[model samples]
Target: MNLKVSKEAAEWYKNEMDLKQGDYIQYYVQLYGGIPTVHPNYSLGVSIGKAENIAIKDVVEGITFYFNSDDAWFLEEFDMEVVFEKEELEFIFHKK
Candidate 1:
């Protein structure tokens, strides 16, 4: 999957860690698990994606990427466990 990083997110990352544009980021999302009307806790699952070359601000909503030609996802926050394995394709960031 190709993941795009926003300017704000990138800046925040740079300030928090020793990373650059081509670096891979690990992140998680909260999955609401509960009754239909009730909010549930987040159950995090690991997903791999790339960081695009776009600024967070440019991405008014959030970072969006394609898991496939017809499927895509937007990220709320970048997790810290997603890394590129030796055989994994690098997710590059794109500037908006």
Candidate 2:
């Protein structure tokens, strides 16, 4: 699995989330309310926190974006790319 964050997306997050260089962005599986490509009735969630067991990650603009080991089931079979589009951030999943 791979985690990729586009430069535009990283800038968007930095500005929108009011984050600094050392901040951590975590991507996790949430119950609902997003356009999820991997699982039905599920979606991705973003938060700022330190990782305990990072399975995959990408650093952009000095911010660390990652997925925890416990969320492997959601990402193990796909490459995730976060991009900025239409003035918002989008999550795209490419099946491995």
Candidate 3:
């Protein structure tokens, strides 16, 4: 997929996300609406879909990049309480 990441996300992907070359970075890209799962509930949170992970190849966008299952599942079940803007950040590194 063609993930569109913000400058902040790009920096995270390059640094924080710890992405290598082929890891899987799960993300719930915002296409429709509602605040991201990570962000706290907002009067203007986007009403998109449930959070999911995207392999490095599929992750085209999102802010919260998960490194392990705990992070991924926590994000997947994140309550709308944190108000952090969402953007794409590649985190998953696929194994060859």
Candidate 4:
């Protein structure tokens, strides 16, 4: 599925979060809307529904990319609050 990410996001993951190509970065949407505590890593805060996990695939500007649907359940139902793992950077990862 095609996911949309901001240039800011890509850079944040790379520079601050040490993300690189082929990294399996995790993206989850806030099912509801609310403000999260500020952090140096997430200075812009978070955007709900900003990252969507789709069932198909493609790449384009204004889109974020996910590895694949191998773990779709975590995104769709199981791991709803994956965003809260930011402190440990546990929810996201690079393929390597």
Say which candidate scores most in lDDT. 2
Error of 2 at 43 (Å): 0.8
Off by over 4 Å in 2: none
Supply candidate 3's per-residue lDDT for 19.
Answer: 48
- TM-score list, all predictions: 0.30, 0.91, 0.26, 0.32
For candidate 1, write residues 1-96 as lDDT tens digits: 235444554555444555554454443334663212111354333233465433322221233322322122332233212223453323333322
Model 4 misplaced regions, further than 4 Å: 28-64, 67-96
Q: lDDT of all the models against the reference? A: 0.36, 0.87, 0.34, 0.36
Evaluated at residue 13, the lDDT of candidate 1 is 49
Over the stretch 26-71, how does candidate 2's per-residue lDDT look in tens digits?
A: 8888898755767888888789969478878899999999988888
lDDT of 4 by residue, 5-82 (tens): 444445555566554554444433333333231222221123212234545322323333453354343333222222
Superposed by TM-score, candidate 3 places the C-alpha of residue 35 at a distance from the truth, in angstroms, of 5.9
In Å, residue 53's CA in model 2 sits off its true spot by 1.6
Q: Is candidate 3 or 4 superior in lDDT? A: 4
Q: Top TM-score: which candidate number?
A: 2
Give the candidates in order of TM-score, highest first.
2, 4, 1, 3
RMSD of each: 12.7, 1.3, 12.5, 12.4
Q: What is the lDDT of residue 45 in candidate 3?
A: 22
Which one wins by TM-score: 1 or 4?
4
